[model samples]
Target: MPVTKATDADFRQLLDQHEKVVVKYYADWCGNCRLFSPKFKRLSEAEPEVAFLDVNAESSPEARKLANVTNLPYFAVFRNGELLETLAASKEEAVVELISKLHAN
Candidate 1:
């Protein structure tokens, strides 16, 4: 699965369709976001059933607002279109935990 470029129009659709949706808020110029992109992609590939969406923080204001994102790279996990957990503090291990919990549910 490819990283989804999330916009205001498509964001809700992706959330509605997938059992688990992991949305990553990033910026094109942010170094942290750049470093995290590959990891996110690899995670998405490993879990093909999960929908991974990306919202460019610098460009997509609607998406950013919808997700209530403030950091350079923010992660939000939704199950059945309802937000299950949000992790914006930990580095990589946090994301792994989020994925694990999703699989468990």
Candidate 2:
């Protein structure tokens, strides 16, 4: 699926509506986040069955607490509204593996 933007207001509710989701927390000024965006979008297109949600950390204050994101490009994989894992890095292989495992389950 195409990557969608979610804010603090509706991020959780959005995730609750999807069976499999990949939520990415990022900031505009972060180099790591900037570098990962294109790869993430490509992955979303490849894995159209999964919901990809992007959140701008600067604008979404509540996201920090909800996602517990300490790094520039934090990713959280969720299945049926429950968090499966948290990834602190911005790598394509790691994301692909997480989604594949979650979707398989």
Instruction: Estimate the Cα RMSD of every predicted model relative to the unseen true structure.
Output: 1.6, 1.3
> Which residue ranges in model 1 land beyond 4 Å of their true spot?
none
lDDT of 2 by residue, 25-83 (tens): 99999999989999999999998778999999889988656768888798888888788
lDDT of 1: 0.82
Give per-residue lDDT, candidate 2, residue 46. 90
Runs of candidate 2 exceeding 4 Å displacement: none
Q: What is the TM-score of each candidate against the true structure?
A: 0.87, 0.91
> Lowest summed-lDDT stretch of 10 residues in model 1?
83-92
lDDT of every model, 2 decimals: 0.82, 0.86
lDDT by residue for model 1 (1-105), tens: 788888877888888888888888887788888899889999899888898998887777876776688787888888998887777743888888887777774
Best by TM-score: 2
